[model samples]
Target: MAATRLWIAAAHDPAHRNGGWAFVRAGAGGETLGRAGGDRRTTRARMALAGLLAALEDLPPGEALAVVAPRPDALVLHTLLKPPAEPPAADADLRAALAKALGATTPATRTWTLAVGDPAGPTPAAFAAAWADLASDKAKAGGAFVHSIPRPNLAKVQGL
Candidate 1:
């Protein structure tokens, strides 16, 4: 099964119609497929033409699409992407791991990071569930939703 990672970076304005969305599709290995698009549908068509869309469409069961939208908390996101240790099972371990990963974003997000990373707090059963609430907020809709619209609000917590 193939996995698709799309970064739909567009001009900051929705009404501006800047024309052509710059897309970066991460596929097999480190191979990438980038294309220009006048609109969402056209961008998707280009992806299909490149065969990345078809690869994702044929993904096997249990291998669902993983979609992420850009968050307004640029600083926080910057922190999240920073180098972090390997994920650990315990919340306490996760906290330490996130501190390394998210601490760089901002001092404020650092506090929140420790809060959820606490093993005694909400005992998240898995990595995906740990930031489930935040993921929904970041996407501005449930994960089941096919697409998301960027918004000003950001999820208070994020899972690494």
Candidate 2:
């Protein structure tokens, strides 16, 4: 059997040292086979990048991983081999990071969509909707399966 594709929606707030992530396994008709999220103890950019890279590396081969972050710098650094030495300005937006991460000519076969959302408010339904749409689109375009790895909730973080 072929490896499955994973769609990851992450809500990160560097200031609060907390974040939430949801993983979905994509299937025909944009169905989610599995889902999960939780808090990241270390909200530091480097830690976040390391955690994400570790998670992605642990996944089974052929499993395409897509991660969505409120800020794009984290995601860009995760994918680029020779990323800039300095960190992006704290205010940088997701679109800019995505554009930098995915330069021209790179086919977005198994990709991640970075959906920005408020870390202080209730989880945005729009983010979830975007994940669903992307997962469905990818499944249709690549004919690959998708699944979400289990994670923890950020809302439970103390003093959030």
Candidate 3:
């Protein structure tokens, strides 16, 4: 069975403490899908876990997967790689959900890497981070409907 590679990331806006989470999944054949969401007021750790949970929820039954994330999100990696003896006091629900997901998943690899290599060009992590940032902004805006206005360049854009 081919293994799917997943990259999960979270972004937090310190100004309002709003946060978002995103996951990018790439199949063996290189097809990719991404999903992102936000919480009005939350910690980065919570958002990271949420992203992992979201990704796991979307996993196909019995499919093998390998997870990758930045080192800064060690809490998330630790939770998945080596769970604590007891349930965490904070974000217990998310932790429990993650545990459940891990229990059911068939992880292809347990190796953890810190870096995402190049930051110059857009990588999966970068894309996930951008999605997370956008989601955070949307949450700060009270989940209002958003419409896009395209422009040929910086100026001459239509709609406000």
Candidate 4:
């Protein structure tokens, strides 16, 4: 079997204090495939959006990668491409700009999955659970697992 490359990332909105993580996988077929996530306490909508964007941006060029989110509506993936003006006119405008940018290049057959968690105090179990939820949704969602260990506690937690 061919080796698969998967990229995972988490995002958080400092302002709202909400966030979540996402995982994207690129199979040998050159097709973007995977899911996103959204959770109640552990993962928030905004955080999930950030994680999804981070994952997509990290993907290698020309590599097929799919995104999955627990709450697809919360994340406006397209927004990352064409961000709002330097100083966005307003929150709504900024969001719209982001949406347009993210939606611009998306394929019609894109796949999405939803997961749950807390953006703030995300436990190792929560992260693992969310990853499993999204990966199981798609058969091709398999590859190297990349995760960012939060500072302070991350440094203290052994075997993370």
Assess each prediction's global lDDT (C-alpha) against the native: 0.29, 0.39, 0.65, 0.40
Clash pairs (backbone) in predicted model 1: 79-105
lDDT of 4 by residue, 34-57 (tens): 445433223334443444554445
Sort by lDDT, top down from the best: 3, 4, 2, 1
Tens-digit lDDT string for candidate 1 (1-160): 4444443322122343222223333443544433332322222222112222222333333332333322322222233344346533333433343343333334434221111222223221122222222323332322122222222211221232
**What lDDT score goes with residue 109 in model 4?**
23
Candidate 1 segments whose C-alpha is farther than 4 A from its true place: 12-16, 39-63, 72-160
TM-score list, all predictions: 0.26, 0.34, 0.73, 0.32
Clashing pairs in model 3, backbone N/Cα/C closer than 3 A:
none
- Quick one: how many clashes does candidate 3 have? 0
Error of 2 at 66 (Å): 6.3
TM-score of 4: 0.32
**Per-residue alpha-carbon lDDT of model 2 for 61-139, expressed as tens digits?**
3344444344442354454434467746642453243333344234543344444333333433333334433443443
Better of 3 and 4 by lDDT: 3
Ranking by TM-score: 3, 2, 4, 1
